[model samples]
Target: MRIAVLMTNTDESDFSNSWPKDGEKFPAMMRRVRPEWEYVVYSVKDGVFPEVLTGIEGVLITGSPHSVNSGDAWVERLFGLIREIYAAGIPMFGACFGHQAIAKALGGDVAANPKGWVFGLVEKRFADGRSLPLYASHSEQVTKMPKGAEVIASGPDCDVAGFVMGRGVMTTQYHPEMEPAFIAALVEHLADELPSDVTERARASLVKEADMQAMAERIALFIEGQSA
Candidate 1:
């Protein structure tokens, strides 16, 4: 089994390159999860997705600085690929922009987040108490779930933090792979792009290293379970 992570460059002209960019964060986190499947990074900016994703066991799309609603041609193309992957019965997991894209691809809407942006660690309620390692580094969130979606997580600020669609696809508004060091680096790197107040809170959350590890283990299980 193999997991292909669809990555688009965060520095795309329209978006802000705040959080470590797709290249840095996605690879490092995939290593930590150690999905039973070998992991491959398919860069959209480099024109690899349509070819690289072929024959892959499963797919994971990382968060991006760009918005799905931006109407970028690449985003539209990627959205089509996501639909194909879902129709093929392959499991797909999405984070941040990835999450938003998944939602939009499945007949949902993505917006600029009128409430501003959500940054730092948040306590997300898993109705089943199943959420692990809660962290986020985005300004946009999923307001309405995609058609026929079942929400798995929610919080005060965001109505939809995580959701499951069809049989094998899942998308989370929060960053399950985020660690203390990663979060620290992400916040420090994006101090300017992010709201001024959340910087301190983001740093404070990373202090709890154990929680981050526990969260990573949960995600690993979820990713591996797909192969099983």
Candidate 2:
């Protein structure tokens, strides 16, 4: 099986010294979860999309610093691609920015979170009512839900923390692929932009452990299960 990863982040947001780009990081993370599958990346922000969706059994779109409302041409183009992927009936998974993108493409709206940036250790509630603390990093969130979106997970600040759409489409607001070190470096990179109090709380929460492997496995199961 093969999965195409649509990388949306162009620059590393000044974290070059310590963290790898999303494209470089996703494959390594996914491979650890499902080593048998082939993973190919495309720079979607650079307007590179899969010319041929045929034979691409599954898909994963990574998070980005860019917002769904950025009005960048590439983001618009990706919205079209998301629809195509869903129509094509391929199992799809989205992370962070990718989650918001999917929502917007499907008729939802995104706006700046009034509660401000959500950075680290949020307890996300699934539709069934189970909750777990996961690393989080975003200022904006989904304000209005899209038509037909089944919200599977939510946060107090981010109502649509995770959801499942039509045709095996699964998405989450947090980065299942990000390591603790990567999150730390990201916090440092955007400290100047993020509010001081937000960073302080985020840093304090970082001392606690997050099960990166477990998150990876959950995502893997959603993708690999598509084969059956």
Q: Which of the numbered candidates is closest to the native, going by highest TM-score?
A: 2
Candidate 2 Cα errors over 4 Å, as ranges: 226-228
Write model 1 residue lDDT over 94-184, tens digit each, in one string: 8778889999998887776677767777777776875455777677777777778988888647878888875567777877666566666
lDDT of 2 by residue, 100-213 (tens): 888888788889999888997777778777676678888888877778888888886888898887556888898877788878877777789878998888888888756667
Q: Against the hidden reference, what TM-scores do the models get? A: 0.83, 0.92
Error of model 1, residue 130, in angstroms: 4.2
lDDT of each: 0.71, 0.82
Residue 201's lDDT within candidate 2 is: 87
